[model samples]
Structures are given as C-alpha cells and as structure tokens.
Target: MTNRVEYLRSPTAIRERCNELFELAQADQLPYFRVDLTQLDAVADYVIAVIREHYPDLDVPFHSRWRHFEVGNIPRVRQLEQAIESRSKIEQAKAKFDLVIPSVLLDAGAGDCWKYHEATTQKTWARSEGLAIASFDAFCQGAFSKHPYQADATALKQITPEQIGAFFQVGSENPLVGLEGRSALLQKLGQTIEQSPDLFGDVPRPGNLVNYLIGHADQGQLSAVVVLNAVLIGLGEIWSGRLSIEGVNLGDVWKHSSLSGDQLIPFHKLSQWLTYSLLEPLQDLGLKIIDLDQMTGLPEYRNGGLCLDLGLLQLKDPKLAEIPHAADSELIVEWRALTVCLLDRIAATIRKKLGLTPESLPLVKVLQGGTWTAGRKIAAALRPGGTPPIQISSDGTVF
Candidate 1:
C-alpha cells in the first residue's frame, strides 16, 4: 500500500524525478527543451555577484515569506507581534501560521499594471512584495477573522474573493492576473483546514500546525520534509484539477512523458515555500527544523525564468515565447522541472566558490542571495516589463 503514492508525497520525490528528466534532456532525448550546461558557469558568476553585492559578509537568510513582510523596510511581522503583545508565544506563532498559509497561497502573478501603496509605510509596492504587504494589512484588519477582534484559523477557513480582491485592490479598472483562481484556492484552503481537525485542530487554525510539529518533533527537532508533507497532505484538497493517483489529491505533482510507472513529478513549490516561511516562526517556538536543502529549489517562474533568460534552457521552438501556455503544458512543466535540477547544480558551484558548506549556504540562501533575484534582474534587461521568458497561466496556488 505504501508504494508509488508515498513517493508522490515528499519534496524529495520532486527532486528525483526532475533530475531524471534533466538527464534525459541533456542527452537530447526529451522534447520541448534542451539543457545548455555551457552557460551554467556564467549563470553562477552573475548569482555570486548578486550575492556578494547584497550580503557582503554572506549572512543570507533562508528565502521565505518573511522577507516579503518587510517590504519598504517595514518590519510588518514585528509590528504584528507588537500589536498582539498580550498573546502567548505559541499563540503568536500560530497566528503567524494562519497569516502565512493564506498569504503564501494568495501570492501568484499580480500582472504588470497593478500596484499597491502601503498606507502606513508610505511606499509603493508591486508584485510579490505588494501582495505580501496587502495580505499582512488584511490579516491585521481581521480580513481572515470571522469576528472583529483578531485573526483566527477557522476564520481563514472561511475566506472569500471579495476579501482578497478588495485588499489587493482588484477591480475592472485595476485587474489582477488570476484573481478568481487565487480566491478559489484560498477558499478551498479554508475548507481543507476545517475538515482536518486532527492536524489543524478543532478550531483548525493554520498555526495549529505549529503544535503538531512540536508533538512530532524528536528531541526538540523536526524534519523539514515532514513540515512540507503536512502542508501537502493537510491542504491537498486546495489544488483543483491537478493530477491525482489512488484517490489521493497530489497537490502540485504532475504527469510527464519522462516515465510511465509513475510519471508524477511532485513540485510542491508553494508548500516548500511555506515550509521555508515557517522557519523563523518555528524557531520562535523553540523547535529546530533540520535538512533545509532536502526541500529543493522552487521550480516557479523566477528561478525557471533565470534558466531561459540565461540561455541555459533553450525553447525547441523559438516562436513559443509569443504564445500563452497553460501551467501544466509539457513545455512549461519541462521548464519548471529543469529549473529545479539546474538550481542544485548552480548552488553547488556557488558553495564551492564561496568556500561555504551546505549548512552555511544552503540552496535556500543561494536562492535568496540567489537565483530568483538574478533571474528577475536578467528578465528586466532582456524583456519589456521584465516578464518571465515564458508565460504561464498560473492558478494562484501553484506559483
């Protein structure tokens, strides 16, 4: 019974299968894309420069949702703590979990034209940072709450499109990309948490996961993979119309032509992202999460776009850039999978050059000091609006 289904459950599964496809593409056996190892060193050089430029002493934090909360140099999370000073540390951490889960889920493409002005910070924000600030503001305003008092898990379980859209300023004149899809995903996430009282608890708060992790933690330690697995399993029902096997909803896992037995390549990009985001919160709870690199590099737009923009991943058809593609298309999946594989290779070179161990400069740091920034920088130089090299019709959940 614990056969292929188990393989589809972990972040490691995503790494293994993506590695396989990467190798096949290297041998020119896979269609839709080709791997260019020659440009990898150049890619490495650019990322290293970006890393050194920002973090001169190389004190890079793990890339996560926490970074976005501080947009415009505002310590939004710290502010949240100050506002909720009466709560216990555990309660605060749980509140953070509640905010982070939906905030991360709400993070998709905001499109080019839309922008957010943080009224408190007095700074204009756009894209991910804008979304993060807006979500944080909404959380503070009790958008996720059923009562007017405070943010709660059960409240998050009953979120709506109007709440999401109004906070993010979505309207006919100011439209957001994937607005409906984004709203539906968060609404479903609420439902999933409500049903999973065992994991999420009776009130089913997202922060209840912090308590679950604390219980499963061995000698005050928890596995990073377990956190991701919990997110994938607890919220599996959130992602609709994706691949499923044996009656289990494989959240973010997809099919590919690379294998037949279980071509299900799991790229729990957002889940892994949430796992990274929870690092500091769990640390605040006095729990240590080990095996950071086991989660793998995210295979989303920025990292994947770095590969395409750098010429490390060449489209088989040059004209394909002009077309709108579904997120699950063969070409897009291949690109996402390859981005996962290549980020590992690139991280190795970055660590080697910096004379740092994986513990010091994990893939998470490399991504933060790392590839995603480099990709966006390059995309800005190569294309107008700094759009990704390939267009993906992302539902709010996946990206």
Candidate 2:
C-alpha cells in the first residue's frame, strides 16, 4: 500500500488540507483560535489601499522573490542580462534558473539585525532584499561553480559549506539565523543536483530545469502547480530532516491533528514561492504558465502575522503570540494553515471591492499589491521588532 504521508507531498494536498481546516474553523471546530470572517473586510480595505498606492493603475506583478532583487529601482535583472548577453535566450534562461534555484533556497528569514552592504549601490539592505542581492553577487562571482572554468553543469554541482559560509558572512559577531543548517542545505543541494543526471544533466545546473519544462510543456502550456511539483520532486532531499514517508522525502509537509486520513498536511511555501519566482523566467522562454490561482498563498509569518495584527485571527489565550513556538507546534501549524485559508478570503474581498475578476486580479497580484506588505506594516506598528505575532524556531530550512 502507498504511504498516506505521500498525499501531503503535492500542491494539491496543501490546498485540500488547508481548505478542510478552513471549513473546520468556520464551524468553530478548531480549538487554538477563532476566526471572524466578517472581520476580513477591514483587512481587505487596508490591503486594497496599499495595492492602489503601490500600483496606481492596478497593474501588479506576481509576488515572487525576484521583486526583492528589484528593490530601490535597481535593474538587477538587466545587469544580469548584460552579464550573460553572450548566451542565447534559451541558455540565458538556464543560467537564470541556475541562479534563482539556489538563491530562493537560501532565502529564509534573516532575522532583524543582520544586513548586507552593496558595494556598488553604496547602500545597506537589511532583510530579504539584502539576502537576495548577497546571493546574486555570490552566484555572479561563480560561488556555486566548482571549476569556475567548466563549460557544463558540473560546475554548480560542487558547492561547499566553506564557500557558502564565507560568502554569506556566517561568523561569530554577524550571526545568520540557522547558519549551520543553511550551509549544510546548500552542500546537500549540490549533491542532490549531481545525483539527478537525467533531470540536471552531467553537471547538474539549475538552469537545466528550464529544458525540462519546455520539453514537457503541453502545447506550449504549463500549470504553475506543475512547476511547484517539479521543484518539490527535484530538491526534496536538499531539505534536511523534513518529513519522509515510505522512503519518499515529503519536503515542507507537516502533521496536524485537526485533520485526519493521512494525518500529514502539506504547505510547500518555499517551493511554491520558487514556482512563483519561475514564472517570469519561463515566460521569457515564451511559455504560458496558466492556472495561477491553483497555487495557494504562502503560509509564512508575514502573511500569518497580518491576520493576528488585523484582529482577523484571535488566539484563545492572547499570550501565545509572545511565546516561542517550534516549527511543528500545533499552535503554529494552526496559524499557518489558517493563513492559507484567510488569504483566499482576503483576495476574494479585495477582488469584489476592486470590481475585478480573478482572471484580471489574480491572487498573485493581490499578494504583491499589499497583503504581505500590509502584514509587514502592521507588524512594525504593533511590535517593536517587527516580528511575527507567533515566534517560530527556524532551522534555516523551514520558516
């Protein structure tokens, strides 16, 4: 018999489990918290205001890690384009795939204090943008490449902790959260790539994923969820100590008691975030990735914090927000699962208020417009450190 945990291995499982939890919450069956669906309108208003302010014409882009790189009006991608101008468009796509896969993997929470100084911009970036730039610079310097002279994919298949640690500035005074785990994760990434010759080729370049998508595309069409599944299957082993069932590693899937059957709930937040990031690159190759809404909202702290900050979700004890919780704690599991359901509700309200259809105002744009930003805004307003309402212990692998 197939292992039950295997169901939680896909994007479908994440959505289904989240929806099941939402229905339970709606019926007041969840014990950790109570959700007031009526309160979502206020949250919607706040997000709508933010969206209009940032995107005046409502022309919002998909929410992805790429946006962090374009911070401060920096043409980061254009700079990359100029650097790789010698390669054909297809090869450029591969190079970008190579660059982005590892970059996105390295993008866990950087805590509040650590900052990156961009020598070129002469500015300091504190959070995600800093990490993105730092990772990009490392990639440009060929940090992921082993030979630095090889023409093929094997170059990226030789990353090491020594190289990644120094490049990320993981040291005593400048501590990065989960530095050890993060370093180990990258080294394992190189190993994972090298082992998958059919998918990654002899050298195991991240860009080779572009070829897989292109070749498997159904009549020039692909689903965003399909991209997410590819990421989960390709890099599942890179995440150390994640859930595995029947010898298959279930990356980013967790267990929650509120739901039954497999007893495993999936939330591949980072992988889905990676899928969202891949949209532009694949589109650059002239492939249309349809069914954007099929991908659920990311269940990270920023989005979950927004619910608590906005009073949409209320903890039973109220003091739970201040306590440190493990990544797998039932409290956080509920919070994260609830965030997924609430995001869909929030998007529905915003779309109705804006007089737009899901076709026009997809959840991607809704997120970019202001849901995540509003979460950050509210956090900074309510908390001193701008941390999430509930603290999570990150292993540099899971957020």
Candidate 3:
C-alpha cells in the first residue's frame, strides 16, 4: 500500500500531487478520484467507531439541529436573526467580516506588506518563526480591540471573560480541529464585527485577505497547510489579481497554465460564498459588500451542494468534542487528507459530467459551484437539525 499519510503535512508534496491528480482528472480517470472514496468512508466510519470504542459514554457534539440556548441572558442566534432582518446592516457586516478577520488571523509579521488600516499593528508584533499559536493570538487581540465591543463596563461585564480571552490564544483556537486553530476565530471575529460594527470597520479591503493568506503561508520560510486552509477558506480571491510569482506574472502564467482559456469558472463565486458565510455577521453591521459572485471556491469541494452530504468532508467526531482533536496526529491527518481527496473526487465528477478538457476546464469554477457550495450547504443544513456542533471555546482565534 502506498502510504497516503505523508501528503497532508507536506505543502510541496501536496501541490505536486494535486497537480498530478488534476492531470488524471482531466483524462476522466475514475481511479484517480474514486479509488479511495470507499476507504475514506470507512475511515469516517472508523472514526466514529473509534470514538464509540474508546469512549462509549462520550456524547459527540454532532447536534445537527436547531435549539435555543441563552448566553449572558441573551440569545446569540436570535440576536443574529434580529440584526439581519434589516437590509443595510446586512451589507455592512458581510464586507467587513470578509475583508477583516482573515487578515487578523495571519501572523503579525507577515501581513505587513499589504497596506491595511492596521498593517502597522501586524508589522509591529512580528511573530517568532514557527510560533503560529502565539502569533495568531496576538493578531486576534489587535483585531478584537479594533472590533466592535462594548466600550462601557456594563457590557464588558456581560461579555463572557472566557470568550473574550479565547480570542487571544494564538495556537489553534477552534474547538474541533486543533491544529493551529484558524477558522473558528475568524468566524467569531466575523460575528463580532457583525454584532458591533460601531467598533470594527466594515468591508475587508480587496486582496487584503488574500495577501494575508499568501504572506502568512510564506512566513518562517515554510508553508503551513493548516494556515493555508485558513487563508483559502476565509479569504480566497474572487478574481485572480495580476501578480508576479517566480518572475512570471499570474495573468500570463495563468494563460499557459492548465486552466487557461477555460470557461471562467467563477471560482471566486465559491470563495465569495465562503466569504459570505464567514462574514454574514459583519454584514449585519451596516457595511457594504462586494457582489457574492465575485470569488471562487477552493478545490476541496467541486460541483456544488453539501460537502458533508457528498461525503467529501466530515466534522470532527462530536464524541471527541473536548479533546482538542486537531492536535491528534493520526486523526487530523486522516480527516484533512480525506477531505482533500474527496474534494478531488468532486472535481473529477464535474470533469466527466461537463465534458470539459483538463487544460481548459474551469477547475476553480467547479470548486466554487460544486464542492465549496456543498461545504456551506452542509454548514447551513446543520443549523436546524440539532444543536450545531460549534462549541464556544476560549481560543483567541475564531473559525
């Protein structure tokens, strides 16, 4: 058996293999994408099995339904519903969360090249090499201070101290995948921005989110895959910006690249969707938003709809709810890799269904229309089924 395990940790290897898979997918080779679906399904089944095996008593947080809970004697979800009932507030929160939180989660040292409102804060913090958690925490603190929080002591007291402090933990702050928590904090920050635009600015600057992702990925002279997920998922580009990579401009390079001259996939549409998902709270705060159709989705999900339903991605086993599951070496690698492979499966399905040639196919398009949409759909689907699996953890970062 070729050990498929190593691919998750290695960026260079991942990019390389992804290219290889892309080629295979272009040829409509089913084995390239579907070979491991059964295995992945088994893996997911096994994870649940393992949880049941080891901790039969563990209650997984897979509350995929809706229920009301009070926090600070106020209903958080209800507050959100009330806010977005208005039209203008909806626009503001969306743009702000989309543009702001992604940049806020990057390491303090790297987001500097991009000229943002508080780029100086990023430049000043200067994260230590390989210190993602600490760096992320510092970024959150700065961003939070800049967010719309109550200036008055009464409101401050009403706020959960744990929630407030959770915003500053630099390393993985998410309740689930613990590997350098990224998404949850961004999500939280987005919600905060949505709820309190009076404090945080509306509208994430064009490309600021992307710049932060790229720059943070390159920091310490090494790329972190977890960080990459944070960047791509939270702040991907709606349109490819003209930029130099390895002495070649992206626009020119893209032409010669496999996806060039292909029907524009509107990959940014998926990205825009995800950006919208992340930024909806910000939208509630009275900021203007860019058009949702502007961004593309990540290759992780292709052909739209629910990613969880399509079996491409699965949430962390709710049974391991409190264990900081992302830090589990075996589990994290298995889940992320499974997700990646499934995403490719979605692309392969699209290629075959659409009759598009590989070189000219809108790979980014499929990602936006297909898989990314699925992930968001699944996320939305989970809202009404049970108590959503999202746990309020005390990590300074939000997913």
Candidate 4:
C-alpha cells in the first residue's frame, strides 16, 4: 500500500496519478479531460490576460436572455456565433459558453432560473423569474435576498423601497418591488456594465450586458470552479441536448473495461470528481443551492469511446506557433481530448489510496472530493456571488 505522503510528493507520481484516472475513464467509457497543473499557471496567465484586457473589475452584474422578454435587434449574438464558427470544437464550445455565461449567473441568482428556448416550437418556457429573490430571503431570513438598500416606503416619482424588494422574492402577494425588481436589478446591474465600456456599451440592451457579465471575474479557485462549472452545465444544457450525466452506472462501466491500472489511477476519479466540487464553497458562502445536480455531466470522450481511445491522439503531428490560440489549429482540440484521457488515469489512483471501491465511489462523489471545490473557494475571494459560478468577469472568455 502506498502511503498518502508518498502519493502527495512528486510530480511524476502525480502524473502517474493522472494516468490512473484516464485508465478508469477508459474503463467506464466516460468523457474525461485532463487539467494540466504544470500548465495551469500558464493557462491561468492566458486567462488573466484576456480577463484583464476585458473585465478588470471586482464587481460585475449578472444578466442574460431570460431577463429579456423580447430579443432586441443586436449583432452581439451574431458576433459570438461568428467568432465561434471560425474556431475549433473546443474553442467553439468555449466561445458559445462565453456568449451566454452571464445569463447563467443571473439564472443562478434567480435560484436556478431556466427556460427552454424552443426553436422548434418558437416559444420559450420559464419558471417564475423573481422566485430566487422571494425564496432566498425566506430561506435565510433576509440574508440571501436581504432588503439592505432601503430608499423609501412609498413614493410615486422616485423608485420605492417596496418596488425594489419585489424583483428577487421567491413569492410575494403584497410584494414590495413586485415585478419591478427585475428592472431594479437590471439598473443595479448597470454598475458592472458602466465599468466596462468596451465589453458592454452604455445602452439599454441585452447582448452588451451579456458580454459584460461574461467578462466579469469572480475571486479564487473554488469560486472560479463554481461559476465556470455552473456556466458549463448551463451552456451544455442549452446548447446540447439535456445533459445526460453517467452517474453510479459509470462504476459498472469502469469495472468491465480493460485499461491498465497505471493509466487508471488518480485520473478517473479526479475527472469525475472535479465536476461539482464547488458545492461546499457555495454553501459556505450562505448561498442556498436548491439542487446540487441541476446540471448534467460532460460528454467529451477521452479514452473510453472515441477515436482518440485507439492511440490516435498520440499519433498527431506537433506544430508550434509563436502565439497559440484555440482558433489557430487542431492542436487545442487534440490537447483537450488528450487531457480528458489523462484525467481519468488520475482518478483511479486517488480512489485506491482512499480505499474506495468503484461502486462506493460514484462519479458525483469524485467531483465532490476534487479541485472544483478549491476553484469555488478561489472564485469567492475574487468576487461576491461566492464562487462566480456563472457571472462573467471582464475576463471575456468561457474558462
């Protein structure tokens, strides 16, 4: 049996740990991605560059299409669509995610506000939007949606305190703000917008607010994880079909596979576990999470069920460019795919060290035990929304 300290010592050992996770994912046929800790700083630097060039603000407003009862005539959506169309699958995915991440954050603020945009039906379906505000105060007793900014009790010309209170209420009969909280929140949301003129112009529009929200940055690792993960979940659900997460059944799938143990250790569990690890941080921040697993898991295959599984990724030709961006080449996609496989390898080893069986250690539990938690914590420090979860920072990209 390997001692815990020994496993925690060397990078080579950690790499081996990653290899194990990949093997496990291969066994379960799960879509896993490897996150390079060595390159994490580099990737973070890239992220920081983009964010600084774009967001550069500590406070950001959360907005989305859900707030817009009607779609305004703006090329913002088209700009995003065009940017993504010219990029690779991974980059395209990221772009699409960036396009609407603010919407996701606002949705989170509205207590998981989601509405099915039916292109087929030409009609959208939405849960009552103000539910978050109403319910939050009730849940935490004026903490979640606390009525802190009291302007007035009743006034016709000026915005009333009663009027401001209604927007976020979960439910209100003789509500204070009534349906006006949306506008008030939208007005308060302008603070984030005005901060970034390039990202979000000074206009009563949706897309710019959306862009500004995306560019906004949350605090540290844990917060980043929460915000990013939630955004990923939201985007996946909106863009892709309903996110079909492979839950406990993944263990059954992993047990029947033939991947080597070396490749399976550390990576498998880590890949799966990293998904929802931000929950603790969100709860710690006094945010009430109505549903822990609202978003489903990803489907980007690494080893188990993709061409890359047959050692195709290892066969790819390597090319170097002075400035590497996802829009540049297949390098990003191939690297991302390789990452998925590698992540699985890491999970398997960690599971063994923890003396956890595959059945006892489902995919969700892995997410709960991983770096996503740390990501959420980091994000909390970056900005309020306690984990950034979906709020866009001027960082300007879907990280």
Candidate 5:
C-alpha cells in the first residue's frame, strides 16, 4: 500500500495510468468521452497559429504561474526583483518561493463574476490575471509575514477567511469563489510547514524550502521530479478530504471506474503546477533543472477544455457541459486523464509541424506558446466570458 501510494505520486504513474485511459479511449471502451484522432490535425494547426502569434521567434518559456504575473504587458516580476535588489541571489530565490507558493495555492479558478481592481496599475483584471495581481499585491504588503516580503509559518497560521477576502478585495459586490476554502488551505499550509521543520527550517517559512532543495541538489543541479517529490512530500497534507493510503494523503489524485483493482488515478495537477512554478526560482539560483520534459502537461481546465473545444474529445452526453461537476467525479477524472494523454499527442504533432524536436519545444513550452492560449482563444469564441466548456465546482484548491 505504501509503495502504491508512492507510485501514484510520480510522473511515471501519471503518464502510465493516464495512457491506460487513453488506450481505452482509443478503443471506445470508456463510458464518458470519445477519442477523435481525426480532429488532432486541426487542433495542432490552431495551436501553431497561436504560437506564431504569441512568439514569432518560437522562443517560449515554461507554462508556469509566473506568466500570469506579467499580464497586461507589465514587468511585475522585474519590479519585484528591483524591490529586493539588495538581497543575495539565494535570498532572492527564497523570496520568490515565498511569494509564488501561496500565489499558486490560491490559483484555483476564480468564477466568472470576480474581478480585481489593482490600485497600483489602476487596471481592472479578471480570471487568472486578476488572481495573480491580487496575490502579488498581498505579498508586497506582507499579508503572509510580519516583514513585507516573506511568508512565515507564524503569519500563515493566523490567516483568516475575512483577512483573505479583504486582501483579495472580496465583498458583497465582488465575490471571489471559494474564499473560505482558500483561507483554510493557507492555514493548513502553515501547519504543514510548521510540522516539517526539516523541510521548512527552524524559523518555519515556505522560503526555507529553498535551503532544502539546495541541500538535495547534486552539485548545483536538480531533477524537476525531485522538486515535485519534495513538494508532494512536504505539503501533501494541505489538501482537504482527499484519498489516503497508509495514512498518506494523496493530493490532487482521484478515482476512475475504468481502472482495475484500486481504480485510482493521480493527476497531481496543482502539485505539478506548483513544481513548474518553483523551477524558475531554482534557476535564478543557477541550478540546472534537468529532465524538464519529465513533468507532465497540467490537466486543468485550459488544457482539458482545448481537447473538448477542438473536438479531439467528445462527451458521450453533451449535457455534461450544462452542469457543474465535482473535482473528483469519474467523468471529470476521465476528462483530465484524457487531457494529459491528448496533450502529449498534440505536442508531438505541434513539434512535427514546427520542425522542432521535443528538446527545442518541450511540453511545458508547448503549453505556453501553444495549447493553453489556444484553448482560451477557442473558448472565448465559442462561449461568453471565455469560460471552459465544462464547468467545475471549485473550492479554491483544485481546478
């Protein structure tokens, strides 16, 4: 059971198990979604156009949370670097982790109604951009620390839903979805950090993870999977009411009826997203991030919606789009697994069309210059407000 739990947490398991579903999808054995290989060319064409539009030179960064921070052509990240200019590179890296960890945790989908008015930019932003800017502002104001630029366990433990609501500008007029769940997740983060002193440090800050990774690095280099393992081991307990094996909480993992025996499938979506977000900070410290392709494409709404919107995936019942699905529902799980599988196919086709290798255009870069933006573009054209084709009931944790 312990080994099984550990296996479920791995990228290897994600790809292997999801591929099993993909094969089932190919055989038309799955109950909910149908695989349409005929539409894959069209999907790749659309993604290539988006990549050319966004990056004419084809130089794309990883599809991390940092991109959202740069919304509206602003150099918010550069501004952050300037603010901490006096700090050493390691400290700066820590500060970036401090800011990004919480920001990513709070990054589950903000419903269509919520919008944030940024006082600094005097700009009204919605969706992921709005959430990113709001969290950025809160971090700058020291909402999670006594000091203005760090996230300490002490401060995070005391964070309340009202405080989170206030920092996010949530009110009767402006309601951020899953406000309480967001707050509870942060508080749990604090508790997790406090308990794992070996990972966090004596003072207990999320930034302290910088030291842990640095210690774990093999001569100034680290594998992305190691970083993901640390993230899952250190913070897996923060997820609420999740499946557990041998008392180990399986964060972002779910069940699918198509599987044999255990019938369990792991997406680890937010955890992998957090891992992707953490890499830049490590890179800033001059550590080479090896095996970047080992990280799977995130199975969130944007990537998943792309498959549905492009007809690469067709729901057996179109009415599934008309209602909200729980994050753990079998249909949603199948949809996410297929998204992960199809994204690989899409990435391979995209590379062939662009005359590039996986090394030149890794899945992460494909996500950035490629599929995610394409998904949003198609969604906006098909639906009002650019909403995903499938509606998910969020708790400010899972997407």
Candidate 6:
C-alpha cells in the first residue's frame, strides 16, 4: 500500500496514469471529452505563433510562478534580489524559496472579480498577477515573518483568513475566492515545516529547504525530480481534505471513473509548479538542474484551457462549460489528465516546427513561450474576462 502510494506521487505515475486516460480518450471510451488530433496541428501552430510573438529569438524561460512576479514589466524579483544582495549565497537562495513557496500556494484561481492595486506603482492588476503582487507586497511587509524577508514557521502557523484577506485587500466588492482555504493551507505549511526538521531544519523556515536540497545534490547537480520529491514529502501535508494512503496524504492526486481499482490519477500540479519555481534559485546557487523534462507539464486551467479553446479537446457535453465543476469531479480529473498528455504532444509539435530538441526547448519552456499564453489569448478572444472554457469552483488550493 505504501509502495503504491509512493508510485502515485512520482512523475512517472503522473505520465503513465494520464496516458492511460488519454488512450481511453483516443478510443472514445471517456465519458466527457473527445480527442481531436486533426485540430492538434492548428493548436500547435497557434502556440508557435504565440511563442514567436513573445520570444522572436526563440529564447524562453521556464513556466513558473516567478513569471507572475514580473507582471506589468515591474522587475519585482529584481527588487527583491537587490534587497537581499548583501546576504550570503545560501541565504539568498533560502529567501527566494521563502517568497515563492507561499506565493505559489496562494496562487490558485482568483476568480474574475478580484484585483490588486499596487500603491508603489499605482497599477491595478488582476488574477494571477494580482495575487502575486499582493503576496509580494505582504512578504515585503513581513506578513510571513518577523524579518521583512523570511517565512518562519512561528508566524505562518498563526495566520488567519482575515489577515490574508487584509493583506490581499479583499472586501465585499473585491472578493477573492477560497479565503479560508488559502489561509488554512499556509497554516498547515507552517506546521509541516515545523514538524519536518530534516527537510526544513531546526529553524523551521521555508528557506531551510535550500539547505536540504543542497545536501541532496550530487556533485552540485540535481535532477528536477529530486526537488519535486522533496517538495511533495516536505509539504504534502499542507493540502486539506485530500486522498491519503496508509496515512500519506495525496495532494493534488484525484479520482476518475474510467480507471479500474482505486481509479486514482495523480496530477501534482502545484507541487510541480513549486519545483519549477525553485529551480532558478538552485541554479543561481550554481547547482546544475538536469533531467528537466522528467517533470511533466503542469495540469492547470491555462494549459488545459489551451486544449479546449483550440479544439484539441471538445467536450461531449458542451453544457459542462456553463456550470462550475468541482476540481475533484471525474469530468475535471479526466480533463486535467488529457491536458497532461496533450501538452507533451503540443511541446513535441512546437519543437519539431522550431527544429529543436527537447533538451533545448523543454516542456517547461514550451509552456512559457508556448501553450499557457496561447490559451489565455484564445480565451480572451472567445469569452469575456479571459475565463477558462471550463469553469472550476476553486477552494484556494487545486485549480
């Protein structure tokens, strides 16, 4: 039982399980969506066009939460770097982890209405950008720690929904979805860090993960999967009301009826996102990050939405789009599983078009220059406020 649970938490499991559903989708055995390979070429072309528009020279960064910090071309991460420039290299890495870990956890759907007004820049930002800026501002003000730049467990365990709401400037008119869930996640994160002394260290800080990963590095080189494993093991318990096996909480893994036995499918979307976000800091510390493609594409709305908007995936029941679906529902789970498979296909097609290999143009880069932005563009053109084709009821956790 424990071994099966461990397998479910692995990247191989994510690919294999999602591929199983994709095969079912291809055979027209799935209940909700149809696979449209004919439209894949058009989808690939659209994503390539978006890539060209964003990066004409074809250089693209990894798709991570860090990109949100650069919203409005504001150089927010640069500002943080400058502030912590005097710290030692290890401390700097820790600070980066401190900021991005919570930021990514807070980065579920912000709904269509919520917006953040940056007092420094006098700019109004919405959605992910807004959430990033809000969390950034809160961190800058020491919302997560006594010091203005660290996230210590003592502070995080005591965080409240009202405090998060205040930090985000949430009010009746400017409501953010899943306020309590977001707060609870952070509180749990604090507890997880405090309890996992081997990973977080005795100091009980999120930044201590830097030390843990550094220790795990083999000759200053690490696989992306190692980082992902640390993330899942260190922070898995932060997830609320998730499936568990032998007392192991399966964060972001879900269920689908098409599969036999447990019918479980894993899509550790946010954990993988956190892993991607952590890579830059590891790289900055001069650690070589290898096996980059081992980590699968994030199975989120943007990437999944790209598939739906471009007709790569068509819903058998078109009415499914009009109603809000729970994140754990079979329809949503299957949609996300199909998304994981399609992103690989899209990445391959994009690489072929650009005459590049997976090494030069990895799935993460494809997501950045490629699919996610294309999805948003298509969504904006197809609907009001650039909403996803399928509406999901968010709980400030899973998308």
- lDDT over C-alpha atoms for residue 374 of model 6: 91
Q: How would you encode candidate 1's per-residue C-alpha lDDT over 1-399 as one tens digit per residue?
A: 356767777776888889889989999888889999999889999999988887898999889989898766667777788877788988888888888888898888888888887888678788998888888888778887864325555566566677678888878877788887887887777788888887988876677888888888899888888888788779888889987776778778777877556577888888889889987889888888798888799898899999888888999998998887888888888899999999999999888888889998988899999898898899999998999988887766678
lDDT at 307 for candidate 2? 89
Residues forming the 10-long window of minimal summed lDDT in candidate 2: 147-156
* Candidate 3, 1-399: lDDT as tens digits: 122222222334444433443444435442212223443444334233433443355332211011111212334335434544553543434323433334334322221121211232342222212223332233334433344311211222233334433443323322222223343433433443333322233443322233343334332232223333343433322112332333321110111122223211111122222343343343233233332211222322212123344443334344543354321122332333334445555545545544544333333334423343344445455554221132233222212
Estimate, for each residue in 118-194, the C-alpha lDDT of model 4 and write its tens digit: 33235443432233223222222222112221111111123333433442332443322123433333333333334
Query: What's each prediction's TM-score?
Result: 0.96, 0.95, 0.31, 0.25, 0.98, 0.99
**Prediction 5 TM-score vs. true:** 0.98
Model 6 compared with the native: what TM-score? 0.99
Q: Can you tell me which runs of candidate 2 are displaced by over 4 Å? A: 1-6, 146-162
| Candidate 4, residue 294: lDDT | 24
Which pairs in model 2 have colliding backbones? 153-203, 154-203
Candidate 4 to truth, TM = 0.25
Error of 1 at 309 (Å): 1.1
After superposition, the stretches of candidate 5 with alpha carbons farther than 4 Å from their true spots are none
Error of 3 at 27 (Å): 23
What is the Cα-based TM-score of model 3?
0.31
Per-residue lDDT of model 6, residues 258-355, tens digit only: 88778899999999999999999999999999999988998889999999888999999998899999999999999999999999999999888889
Window of ten residues with lowest summed lDDT in model 6: 254-263
True lDDT of residue 139, candidate 3: 31
Q: What is candidate 2's lDDT per residue for 130-153, written digit by digit as tens?
A: 889888888777777753311234
Please tell me which model should have the higher lDDT, number 3 or number 4. Answer: 3
The 10-residue segment of model 1 with minimum total lDDT is 147-156
Decide which is better by TM-score, 1 or 5: 5
Which digits, one per residue and each the tens of the lDDT, describe model 5 over residues 328-379? 8988999999999999999999999889998999898999988989999999
lDDT of 4 at 392: 21
- After the best TM-score superposition of candidate 5, give how far the Cα of residue 148 lies from its true spot, in angstroms: 1.7
